[model samples]
Target: MRAFAAAAIGLTAAVALVLTVTAIGPPQDGTSPEPLLTTVPGPKK
Candidate 1:
């Protein structure tokens, strides 16, 4: 019973770590604070 509980806890922690890492995603090719929002601004209509 203790082993089962430990396995469950380890699995949960592993899944959470994977999700957190993926959620943050890879770093962009820039040094900006917010890379996605730091692209060249588009021309106004």
Candidate 2:
């Protein structure tokens, strides 16, 4: 009985998480506008 209750609680939590994510939907801002890192020129040999 204890195992069954635990399994039920886990299943409920998983379903709730999936529903919440679906409701939130995708992000609107999209990708970053600038490059991740800047490059610097190397000293001449």
Candidate 3:
């Protein structure tokens, strides 16, 4: 049925995504090299 086909497609996509991310693994460093902006800047004079 169409519902079954859709479910299979979703499952396959999810598995592929998990495998890809697993292979890539996490970053070596705990933190990022570039600093992340946390606050908005004030208006310039």
Candidate 4:
């Protein structure tokens, strides 16, 4: 019974987490940024 209760609690927490993540709406700014790292140096090895 104890194990069952623990499993139930864990499952509930996981479901809640998934719901919270998905419920978070998109960014309001509507402006997507570009990558910060464009090029890499230090070669010829």
Candidate 5:
């Protein structure tokens, strides 16, 4: 019974970690903070 309980807890933790990563998406390398920058200012219509 103890072994079975430990396995269940491990499985639950693994699943939780996977779900958390998926929801946040995979890590990105060399990603820029700003891809586009506008310098011009236009009058409001």
Candidate 6:
């Protein structure tokens, strides 16, 4: 009985997470104007 209850709770939480992400939708384009990392300079010869 305890195992069954735990399984049910886990399933409910998973479904809730999926729904929340779906409602939020995908991210918009150009959200970050600048790149995350800058170019590294070449090593001196």
lDDT string, candidate 4, 2-34, tens digits: 999999999999999999988996677876577
Which scores greater on lDDT, model 1 or model 2?
2
Candidate achieving the largest lDDT:
3
> Lowest summed lDDT over 10 consecutive residues: which window, candidate 1?
30-39
**Clash totals in order:** 0, 0, 0, 0, 0, 0
Q: Please provide, for model 5 over 1-45, each residue's C-alpha lDDT reduced to its tens digit, 9 standing for 90 to 100.
A: 999999999999999999999999967776778867567667889
Clashes in predicted model 1: 0
Clash pairs (backbone) in predicted model 1 = none
Off by over 4 Å in 5: 28-45
Predicted candidate 2 versus true structure: per-residue lDDT over 25-44, tens digit per residue:
98988988888757786888
Off by over 4 Å in 2: 32-45
TM-score, every prediction: 0.60, 0.63, 0.63, 0.57, 0.58, 0.62
**lDDT (CA) per prediction:** 0.90, 0.93, 0.94, 0.87, 0.89, 0.90
Can you give the lDDT of residue 26 in candidate 1?
A: 88
Question: What tens-digit string does per-residue lDDT give for candidate 6 at 1-45?
Answer: 999999999999999999999999988663777767667868889
Candidate 6 residues lying further than 4 Å off, grouped into runs, are: 30-45
Q: How accurate is candidate 3 locally (lDDT)?
A: 0.94
After superposition on all C-alphas, the RMSD of every candidate to the true structure, in Å, is 8.5, 5.4, 3.0, 4.1, 9.7, 4.2
Q: Model 5 compared with the native: what TM-score?
A: 0.58
lDDT of 3 by residue, 1-45 (tens): 999999999999999999999999998878867988899988999
Model 3: runs farther than 4 Å from truth? 32-45
User: On a 0 to 100 scale, what is the lDDT of residue 25 in model 6?
Assistant: 90
